[model samples]
Target: MNRTDLGPQRIVCLTEETTEWLYLLGQQHRIVGISGYTVRPPQARHEKPKVSAFLSAKIDKILALQPDHVFGFSDLQADIAAALVRAGVAVTVFNQRSVDDIVAVLWQVAALVGCTQAAQRWIEAVHAQHAAMRQAVQQRVQRGARRPRVYFEEWDDPPITAIRWVSELIDIAGGEDIFPERACQPLAKDRVLADPLEVVRRAPDIIVGSWCGKKFRPERVAARPGWQDIPAVRQGHLFEVKSADILQPGPAALTDGVAQLHRIVLAWMDGQVAAVLGQGGVAQAGGCHA
Candidate 1:
């Protein structure tokens, strides 16, 4: 369909990343509604009316808006999409589970809106940025000395770890994620650490939390039982990376999340060496045995 004839002049986005991507591609005029939780770009909140939330939506309200298309993310949104579809509104759900999948979804969305050329250029630019960042991280790892084990917490109640894209970002940043095996699982239950002692056993050198739309409580994490013995806690390596910066599964995650990971890992590595030299007057520190 032509950009003018795509029948999506009134669109509703169920997630922040899709809304942000459409805005970036100059398709904001087509968006009629957005998620209540969208904070990215800042302008989206002011521009679009909030009609839905992640995993749940006001179906009647969305229908009243007369949106021709509804955009949602994941199986979590399947019901929302089905409801809209049953009401004769077209819906597209993206279930991107990896960094590559996210980029591909962006392209697909752009294509749906007849902005394929713009999407191609945008993808190329992001790919170039990723390559350059990867190279820089590799150089830093080779020269600056060490790689740390990172434990990335996506939630804390049941203790969920990083998802696939987040784990990949950690790898790109020159750090190894402690729960790499669980990264591919989409459900929180699959990624949750059943035993708090598992975290203690992993003994990560850095613990980063991004509690999925909630503010991470590092102090709360630091106070967990048996966590006092974890090296990350002892060295004050516990940190909070905002959910917007990492959990979005789009350009924001690639840019801001990877940068945050690199900064934290590099700082932790430097701190370890500094601590050893300060204590023993020697630069040698058995450099990141992880």
Candidate 2:
């Protein structure tokens, strides 16, 4: 008997994004193992045996799987990649910190799994959806609305802001990320909010909490001392977007995540317009949040 090799028959994904992408591209059958954190397609958790976590994996168990290729994400996973490499296992680690890189990763992974055509079609659809959403926001601006000020809380302990892709998505969703500079930094330490008062000072109209896999408790955020005057807290604009929907850096973040963001930001814009009309301020520039 002879076995025909289609590219990378036995694949292990050390991150949720790649696992989710492969499943989306109809290449899930090639996956031999997946990260325990994958929840985008909840069925993945049940169908695939959990073999890895975000920062660690069962190395011996992974070796036992005999994967021909292992895909990981970011410098955070460099140690795992290195260990696998030392054992002569093929490894590819991607550092996709921004929206563009994530879109590109989709195509690259699909190509490896011999599904480039399907992947390209899906990618084009996603891009089209993004463009349509941006256009809708642009129309809103033309009708006397401004982008909302958005603060995406990636972590709550020290109040880390958005990551690169989330920042870009905020712009597309008719909101301006308050901490755009922080998003450029790949490491969370660099993006940490050193001064909690900085958030109040920025005066965001909307607060989106993802909180890195934990339940986002907006009440806790509102209860922070001196946060009473913050516009988002005062106006009851704090909202929670689950990490699985917004932080994966792949289709989930680019499509569903951004859509949710657009809805939230647009609603805020509507509220701003209503407030101006109620005050009889002539609705000049609709808040000019950015």
Candidate 3:
């Protein structure tokens, strides 16, 4: 019953990304427990016992599971990792804030479970998807289509903008993140908008809200003070992308997340053309169609 040769046969994932990644790599069988927030692969929710949330875990429950290794994400989980280590459980916490870091971490996780080849193949598909999006965006730009100014709201209250990986995905999806500078900040507190009016001043063509785990209320955002003047509000360009899709720093972000973004940007482009044709004037960017 020696386990070292099998590479972490019993694993616990304290976050959605690692759980989803392991499931994608066909290593879900090794997972003994998962974060309660995992929703990427719906089956995971039913198949695995939920042992942890983002910032907290049932340590006693986890211990009972006897996981050989545990995976977590970010410094937010540092305390959880520390406690696990103290109990002699091997813990690897990945702080992947950007797209490249996410890909690299996925590779490392796959390697731990002896699924490097599968991970490589999946990573290649992700790269191909990204390249295809980039090319499509380039083609649009060449055809005189303007990239929309995207304001992705990670949290509505105090208004936290997109993270680094999300910002890069916006660019690849043919939209420029209005708060690119702030998105580079690794910490959510640092990325928070000090002044709510800053979003109004930025004049984004599209506003995407993924308010952590809370449902994004478009009416609430549109009702913000002076937000009616903002182009996104005026044109009704506000949309909600589920937090599990875009906020998770893994395959979901790379695939469904970016794909949704691309569709939004493309729809905006089409709206611009329609507006120009209907008005018989120059095409103005930023208008919600439906």
Best by lDDT: 3
Off by over 4 Å in 1: 1-7, 272-290
User: Which candidate, 1 or 3, would have the higher TM-score against the true structure?
Assistant: 3
The residue-level lDDT of candidate 3 at 116 comes to 78
lDDT string for model 3 (1-290, tens) is 21224689899989888888888877788999998877768898899999987788999999999999999887888999999999999999888888999899998888787777788889999899889988887888899988899999888778888899999999988899999998778888898888999999999988888777676777899999999999888988877677777788888888988988887887787675223221211111111100
Off by over 4 Å in 2: 1-5, 272-290
lDDT of 2 by residue, 172-239 (tens): 88899999988888888888888888999999988888877666777899999888889989888887
Greater-TM-score candidate between 1 and 2:
2
lDDT of 3 at 75: 82
Worst 10 residues of 1 by lDDT: 281-290
* Clashes per model (N, Cα, C within 3 A): 0, 0, 0
lDDT of 1 at 172: 79
Tell me the alpha-carbon RMSD of every candidate: 7.5, 7.6, 6.9
State how far residue 178 of model 1 sits from its true place (Å). Answer: 0.7
lDDT of 1 at 141: 66
The per-residue C-alpha lDDT of model 3 at residue 1 equals 23
